[model samples]
Target: MSSTIDESAYVEASNGQACLAFKDEKQEARFELGVSMMVYKWDALSIAVENGWGGPESAEKRDWVTAVIVDLFKSEKIVDVTLIEETLLYAMADEFDTNVEDDSALPIAAGIVEIYKQCDAQDFSTVEKLYLEWTEKQKNKEGKRIVQVEEDPLNPDASESEEEEEDVEFEIEDSMAVDEMTENNTEPVVDEDGFELVQKKGRRRNN
Candidate 1:
């Protein structure tokens, strides 16, 4: 969309200090405001109060909530909050005074969904969307992305490597060495009869 500023509506201030309103009409501020329209119809703090974990403390919580949302979409190139929160179209409660009801118990989760519905494309980008999705998953226990395990190849059991061949060769050599040791081991035994104990029984009698 083009800016609503008329080309002739801007002029230098006295002594060229700054630009002055070329037209003395009330058109400039409105034009500027029109150029940059309100992305969301409702106030952010109100949304935070209704949907955010903190309710009456929303004034304090707004900055943090906006920060979380900013972080969520900061990484994205574009975000479609309408698409994300389309399911919760009817969940948006009317924008009420922050001081009205302390414990109104706005279906906090559903309220969050509705607040998300109010988000516009400019408010958040794709990166922020993914981050918010990640955060929500973390909070809801379903936020984590599933790390898909790579499937093994169909021929996984087939050995086509030189390492396997070398392993087989080593196994055969070890078997041969064990077999040779078993075959060649002939333990010798000395018989008691062959090397008899000395018989000096009658020697003392003879002496």
Candidate 2:
């Protein structure tokens, strides 16, 4: 989309080094490691998904992918993945109208960008905050989300169509198969296509 990407606040990156550099008149040494790794990985990950190199469900990799981008290259320090994630997640969450715990943790931006050319002002604001807060959170990893990720309820950064998917309503299960007599977790069943599901109590697919 219209460069949800932004110029660095205090850094720059030239060719031959896949990342952002620090502002130093003397020596000009950069935060090369984080920048290089983030740029390399993020670009590669995006390209891979765009090229259909992974499963539809493999889309889960996008969040892990976004985490690396903000954590390493975006003028942010290491250790803020959680808040950084929560920021992007919540932004996407608000658009989707569902908490992360309810839906799949995939990168919605790539999907949105796939559909629209630019994320409008309201949504761009969220992306802006995501970059800023991510940098702050990296400066302090153990911070909380209510304080770091959530922002004023007015502004947001995303595409108009992104607006459409916000609520992402779903009815995932009717009755789950329980462990007969033990306290434990049971994963869902996946038929050939990898969709996680269990048969609806008394309903079949067509009837």
Candidate 3:
């Protein structure tokens, strides 16, 4: 879904400088949720997280990027497409060491701005469409991964050289690392203030 915004509606003067603010509390909440969905839907970010480019905490780092974007709406009033795009690019570079030179963040930024405009007008159709599309993509993604795993044969009786044993051990260690990183992962609880309330991290188990 594409859209353009009336910049005047979201910007207001605060201490003699322009800042972005939603029309009302309801609008703010909706816009925040939309931003979260948009962040998650970005493929560049998805690849970074899936590949653990930002380390085993890549997923949480992605959420942190989402929160940072949401905070821009909350704290800054003059946020524009350029600013949002910069933020995404910076997050990828800083957290994942990924340089997104293809300008992939532009559309996501535009989508976020469009979401803000739609929510400000009390029109949730765009947000709904995004949610539905994201859900479908996730389902298809999981299905494909399941198929790949099922098709890969695992034979316990197969003889392995030392190099093969090392590779298998590496895979096992990597899987354990990811599990360790995520074992304490908690679902974010968004409040009426359009911010996520994360639970305290759990104790890590010793291997």
Among all candidates shown, the one with the greatest lDDT = 3
| Local accuracy of candidate 3 as per-residue lDDT tens digits, 74-171 | 67857777888899998899888999998778888888877776786789777767667765665554321111122124555545663365344111
Poorly placed runs, candidate 3 (over 4 Å): 3-19, 143-207
lDDT of each residue in 1-207, candidate 1, tens digit only: 112322222111345433322132223222212111221222333343334324333333332332333333333333333322321222222222333233222222223322232232223232234334534543554212222233345645655563354344111111111122356593322123221111111211111
Question: In model 1, which runs have C-alpha deviations exceeding 4 angstroms?
Answer: 1-56, 83-207
Which candidate would rank higher by lDDT, 1 or 2? 2
> What is the C-alpha lDDT profile of model 2 across 1-207, one tens digit per residue?
343432211222445545432233111111222222222233333333333333342233333333343333334332222433354445333322334452232233332221111121122333333435545644664422121223325656666666556535432211102221123354545434332222222211121
Cα lDDT, model 1, residue 167: 40
What is the clash count for each candidate, in the order shown? 8, 9, 3
Which stretch of 10 consecutive residues in model 1 shows the poorest summed lDDT?
196-205
Query: What is the lDDT of every predicted structure here?
Result: 0.28, 0.32, 0.65
- State in Å the error of residue 113, model 1: 17
- Maximum-TM-score candidate: 3
RMSD of every candidate to native, in Å, equals 39.4, 19.5, 8.7
Work out the TM-score per prediction.
0.19, 0.19, 0.65
Model 1 TM-score (2 dp) = 0.19
